[model samples]
Target: MQDRAEETRRAVLQAAAHLFFERGYAATSINDISERSGRTSGAIYFHYTNKEQLALAVVEAHFAAWPALVAHHEAALEPTLRKLVRLSFAVARAFRDDVLVRAGARLWAERRSIAVEMPPPFVDWIATVERMLTQARVEGDLAPHAEPSRDAPTLVAAFFGLHTLSDALDDRVLIEDRLADLWLLLLPGLQSCPAPRALLAEVGAAPRARRAAPTP
Candidate 1:
């Protein structure tokens, strides 16, 4: 029974995430989630009290996924800066491919409409980047004039902005290219390494041909 209940809950969260991503908070409804999950309204209500609670669950689960991603790269045997670059690519891919991530991004953007307080976004991410930058500086990968405390927030903001623009422009199909552009422009200033391009290539951050526009 416990396993079945867990299955039901997962199904409901997955359904809610899809709706929340496709339709903003105000537009998404409990019935919509029920329909998507193919579970009865009562079943969904049994797992989540209301739409607000369900939304919170989806966002919380989304936030929960980051630590594991960070850990994966942290365990890797690579330069701190390389790990940082790889982490950004991983996040961009998540934003592009993960329904939960998409839902969380939209929910975060529309937080004002949510009656319950939502978890704050970007605080932990900024701190993570700062830690990586600090370690990179110690490892002699960071440029002499760079300060992790100051640069971390700016880098995080730029990353967030890049995804936002990609979402608005083409649903993030060009996100990797944009990230490559961003690194190409900033790496020289941020890294002490003699070859930023080589570093980007090592991490597979090279830009690719843009996807053709959809036929009207």
Candidate 2:
């Protein structure tokens, strides 16, 4: 019974995240979340006090999942360059499917320090990106000049820019198809030298985490 309840709660968070991504924080009402998740508002209230709380929890999950997301594109231990390129493609794919992520990008945009006050999930995403960029730099895949600590905001902006363009471009759905072309161009400006294996070794040597397999 406890497990079932926990499952329901997780479902609510995911549904809320999806809704939050599609609708702005103020615009996404509790009713919208309830309806989308196939649960009663009462049930939602059981897990979350209000839309704001739900939004925070939902964003929290997105941040926490960053490691898992980054791990997927790496199939080998010697292709950090390709991994970086693939990461770009993955970002494009995520923005395409996740409406909440799209909305959050706009809402929590790095315009000012004001964005720092966004829901937990938004803050988490920013931090996670900073961490990933830091890792990229350490692996020598990122240019020596790329300052993850001071310029993470810019890196996030570049990623979001790609997402925004992919959406606005009439040929956006096919964006990943031409990802290689863009990656090649980006490669020169970003990396001082190729260091694909460093990334693979890091990802591969890292402790493996066990997760519940997705339900059918």
Candidates' TM-scores?
0.95, 0.61
The number of clashing residue pairs in each candidate reads 0, 6
Cα deviation of 216, candidate 1, in Å: 30
Task: List where candidate 1 sits over 4 angstroms from the true fold.
Answer: 209-216
lDDT against the true structure, per candidate, is: 0.92, 0.59
Tens digit of per-residue lDDT, candidate 2, span 114-213: 2234543334445655676676676766787767666556555656566567667843675554344444444465666744333324433211344889
Highest lDDT against the true fold, candidate: 1
